[model samples]
Target chain A: MLVELEDVSKRYQLGNLWVDALRGINLTIERGEFLAVKGPSGSGKSTLLNILSALDHCDSGSVEIEGINLSALNEHQCSLFRRRHIGIVFQSFNLIPVLTALENVIYPLTLSGTVNAKARAEKALEAVGLEQLMSQRPTQLSGGQMQRVAIARAIVSQPNLILADEPTANLDSVTSESIMSLMKQLNREQGVTFVIATHDNYVTGLASRVITVRDGELVEDEPSPPFTLQEAIA
Target chain B: MGLGWKVALLNIMRNGRRSLITLAAIVFGCTSLIVFGGFVQSMYDGMRESMIRSQLGHIQIYANGYNQYGKAEPEKYLIPDRDLSTISQLIESESNALVVAPRLNFNGLLSDGKQSIAITGIGIDAEKEVMLSSAIRIVDGEDLFPEDIEAAHLGEGLFNALDVQVGDYLTLLASTQDGAINAVDVQVMGVISTGVKALDDRLLRVNLPLAQELLYTSDITRMVVLLDETQLTDTAISTLVSAFEQHHLDLELKSWEELAGYYHQVVGLFNGVFEFITVIVLIIVALSISNTMLMAVMERTRELGTIRAMGGTPRQVVSLILLESVFLGLIGSLLGLLMGALAAKGITYAEWMMPRPPGSTQDYPIRVFVVPDILFRTFLLGFAISLVSSLYPAVKASRLPVVKALRFT
Candidate 1:
C-alpha cells in the first residue's frame, strides 16, 4: 500500500459549535491508483486531502504514507518529506505571480535540490504542451494554461503521489477534460498515484476508483470504468 | 541572481508605490546624516584654523614655571634674551617648522592727552607678525614698519574708544623693571580687527623695542612656532620638547589644541546633538522598513502558503523576506550617497556666505567636506538597521502554519 489511513478523526470549532470535519475514516490506496474524491462543498474532501498530503494533521489516527507514520514527524520534517515524496495541485492554480511558467515548474525541483533542475522543468512543461508559454507569467496565461503550468510544477519532481484539490474547478468543460486526461495519462505511464478531491462529473468519470464523501464521512469506495483519450476526443 | 533573489527583486518592483515610499525614507535619512556630518566637520576645520592663525601658533614655547606663576608676577617668568636665540635655533632645525616669533605681553594706561583708558599691550616682531598673524585684519591704515619703534597698531574698538587716528601720537605709561614709573609717546600706524569682541576691546600692538624701552627690560615672554601643516603638530611638539630636554634648557611647550579650550567644548556639544539626531533618523528608518516588510508578508499569505506546501523550509522562507529588505537598504543607501555628494558639490561651488557665529564679527563662506570614512559608516548603518528591522517580520512569516496559510482568503 502506498497510503494507509486508519481510524482518522478530525473536528473544527465553528463559532460556538464543534463541526466534525472527518470522523473515524479508514482507507487504503495502492500504487498507480487514479482516485477521485467526490463530495459536496464542505464535505471534508479538502480536509482529507490536506491530511493525506501531510499539509495538515489528523486529530486521532495513523496516517502512513510509504510505510512512514506522518504523525511522528514535526512540521519541518513533514515539509521535507512532502518536498521529496508528495506533489499537490490547487484549484486556483497557485503559480507565483512574479515567476514565469518555467520558473514555477522548476520551483518543486529546486526545493528538492535536484541537479539540472532547468532541464527537468523544461521537460515537464513540454510534456504539458506548454513549451510555447514557458516564459509567460501567470497573469499573461489563460485559466487553462495556468492549470497546465500548475500540473507541470506538481509532477516535475516525479513524486510518488500527487494530491490535487479541485484541480480543474476553474477551467471550462473542454479544458477540464484535457486536464483530467493529462493527469490520467501521467498516472498510467509513470505509475504515479493520484488522489484528487473534486466535484466535477468529468473528473469523476476519468478516475479508476471513485470515493464518495458526505457530512465528513466516507460513504462509498468503488472501482470505476477506466477513462481513455479516444472517448475524450470523441 | 539565484531564484530567491530573483523573486525578491520582482516583488520589490511589483509593489512599486510602497517600495518607493520606504526607499525615500531610507534615502532621506542617509542623505541627512552625510550632509550634516560633512557640514560639522567643515566647521571644526574652520574654527581650528582660525584659532591657530589668530593667537596660538602650532606650538608655543614658554619658560618653565610660566603656567603656574606667570600671571602673579610676569617679570619672574620672562625668558632671557640669550635663551630666546637658543629656542629659535632648535625650532629652525625641525623640518616642519615654518617661522618662529617672540612675543612680550605688558599692561599699561594709554592717553590721547584728553582721556586715558587701561589697555593690555602686545609687543611683537612687526615683520614676523605680518607672516604669522593671518587671522588679524588690518582694517584701516597700514601694518607696522619692520623696526619702527615709534609706530603702533591699536584694535578697532580701542581706537574708536580713544578717538585717535593713524599718525596721532599717544602716550603709553607703565612701571619700569626697577619699579619706577616710565612713559613713552608712540604713533598709531594702523587699526586692526581680530573678529573676537573680547580681545578687540583692550588689545594694542607695538614694536618689541618700544615695549622694552617703556618697561626697561630685555626679557621676552614666549616663542611662537608655525608649522607647514597642522597635522604635524604632535611631531613638532615632541621634537621640540625632547630637544629642549637634551640641551638641558628650562622650557615648556603647548600645542594649539591645548591652548584652544573653546574649540574642544564646541566640538563636544555638536557631537552630542549629532548622536541624538542619528538615533532619531535610525528609528524612523527602522519603523518604515519594518512596516513595509509586515505589509508584504500579509499580502503574500497565499503565495507563502503555496511555497511552504511545495516544501520550502522555514529557513528559506525567512531568508527570502530578509533578502528583500537588504536589497532595499543597499539600493537606498547608495542612492542617498550619490544625492548627498552632488548636493555637497553644489553648495560648495556656490560659495554661500553664512552669518557670523555667536561672539564673532565676520561672515565666512560655507564649505561642505565629505570624508570617506563617514560615507562608509552611513552605508553600513542604514544597511544594518534595515536588516534588524526585517528580523521580526521574517520570523513571523516563517512560523506561519501551512494549511491555514494555503486556505487564507
Candidate 2:
C-alpha cells in the first residue's frame, strides 16, 4: 500500500460551532492505481487531497504515505517528503510566471537535488511535446500548453505519486481528454500512482477505483473497471 | 553562494521599481554622509594644523606649577639648569619628536620716543623656534634668525604705530622688580604679525641672554616641542602622552587640546553633530532598504510559499531574502561612495574661500578631503545597516507557513 488513512478526523473552530471537515475516514490506496475522489464543492474532497499530498496534517488518527506517519513529520520534513515523493498539479497551473516554460519545468528538478538539470529539464519538456516552446513564457502559451507545462513540472523529477486537483477544470473537453490520455499513458509506462479529485465524470470513468463522498463523509468505495486512453483520446 | 545570489538577482529584476526606489534612498544617503564627513574632517585638519604650527607645537613642557600660575612668577616655573640640555637631547632622539626650544617670557616698558607702551618680551633661540614652528612667518619680514636673536623683532602693529624701520634703534625702559627703571637700546631687526590681535600688538622677541638680563633672571620659563605629523596618528598620540609620566620630569607635557582649549572644545562639540548626522543618514538608508525588502516579500508571497513547499527551510528562506537586500545595498552604496568621493574632492580643490570660521577670517572655507579612512568607515557602516535592517523582514518572510503563504492573495 502506498497510502492508508485510518479514522482520520479534522475539525475547525468557527466562532461558536466546531465544524468537522473530515469525519472518521478510512481508506487504502495501493501502488500504481489511478483513483478519483468524486464529491460536491464542500464534501471534503479538497481536504483529503491536501492531506494525501502532505500539504496538511490531520488532527487525529493517522495518514501513512510509503509507511511513514504523515503526522510524525514536521513542516520541513513534510515539504521534503512532498518534493521527493509527491508531485502536485494545481488548478490554476501555478507555474512561476517569471520563468519561461522550460525554466518553470526545470524548477522542480532544481528543488529535488537533480544533477545535470538542464538536460533533464529539456527531456521533460520534450516528453510534454513542448520542446519547441521551451523559451516561451506562460503568458505566450495557450491554456492547453500551459497545463502541459504544469504537468511536465509536476513529473519532472519522476516523483512516485502525483496529486492533481481538477487538473483539467480550466480546459475545453477535447483538450481535457488529451491531457487525461497523456496522464494515463505516463501511469501505465512509469507505474506512478495518481490520485485525482474532480467533479468531472469523464475522470471518474477512468479511475480503477471510484470513491464518492457526500457532506464530508465517504458514501461509497467500489472497485472500478480498468481505465484506458482509447476512450479518452476518442 | 551562487544559489542564494542568483535568486536574489532575479528577485531584484522581478521587482525593479521597488528596488530602484530603495537604491535611490541609499545612494543619496550615502553620498550626503560621505561628503559631510569628509568636509568636517578636512576642516578640522586645516584649523588644527594652522594652530599647531603658529603657536603651540603638538607638545609643550612646562614647570610643575607652570600651567596653573607659573605665568605670574616666571622664575618659579623655570626648569632646573642641569636638566635643560639633557631633556632637549632626549626629546630630539625619539621618532618624529624633535625641535625643543626654551623660552623666557618677561614684561617690560617700551618707548618709541613719541609714546610709551607696555610690552611683553619672549626670549628664544630663533633657530630652534624656526624648526619648532613656535610662530608663523608673517608677510612683511623674515622669521627670527639665530643672528637676530641678539636683537629684538618688533610686532608689525607696534612697528607701524612707532613708525620705525627694520634698522631703527629704540630705547625700551623696563621697571625692575625692585622698582628701578632699567633701560636698554634695542634694535628693531624685523616686524612680525600673528592672527591673534592682542599678541601682535604687545609682544617682542629678543635673544635669550638679552631677555634674561632685562628680566633680571637666569631661570628658564617654558619648553616648546615640535612633533612630526606622522607621530600624531590615532594610537601613537595617546601612547606618547601617557609615556610622559614615566619620564619623571618636574614638568607637564601639554598636548594640542590643553594648549588651544577653545579650539579643542569647539571641535569636540561639533563631533557629536557629525556623528549624529552620519547615523541619521544611515538610518534613512536602513529604513528604505527594510521597506523595500518587506514589499518584495509581500509581493512574492506565492513564490516564497512555492519555495517553502519545495523544501526550503525558514533559515534558508531568510538567508535568500537577506542576501538579496545586501546585494542591492552593496551595489548602491558603492556607487554612492564613489560619486560622493569625487564630489568631495572636487569641492575641496576648488579653493573656495571660507568665511571667517566663527573666530577666524571670512572665507566660506569648506574643505572636502575624501580621506580613504573616512570612506572605509562609511562603507562598513552602510553595509552593516543594510544587512541589519533586512533581518526582521527576512525572518518574517522565512517563518511564514507554506499553506498560509501559498493561500496569500
In terms of lDDT, the best-performing candidate is 1
Best-matching candidate per TM-score: 1
Off by over 4 Å in 2: A13-19, A112-114, A226-234, B63-72, B79-101, B106-213, B227-267, B361-364
True contacts kept of each: 0.78, 0.37
Each candidate: how many clashes?
Answer: 0, 11
lDDT (tens digit, per residue) of candidate 1 on A151-233 = 89999988999999999889999999888888988887788999999999888877889999898899999875443443355
- Model 2, B233-293: lDDT tens digits are 3343455445545666666667776677767776887788989988788888888888888
For the candidates in turn, chain A alone yields TM-scores of: 0.95, 0.93
* Worst-scoring 10-residue span by lDDT in model 1 chain A: A225-234
Task: State residue B166's C-alpha deviation in candidate 1, in Å.
Answer: 4.2
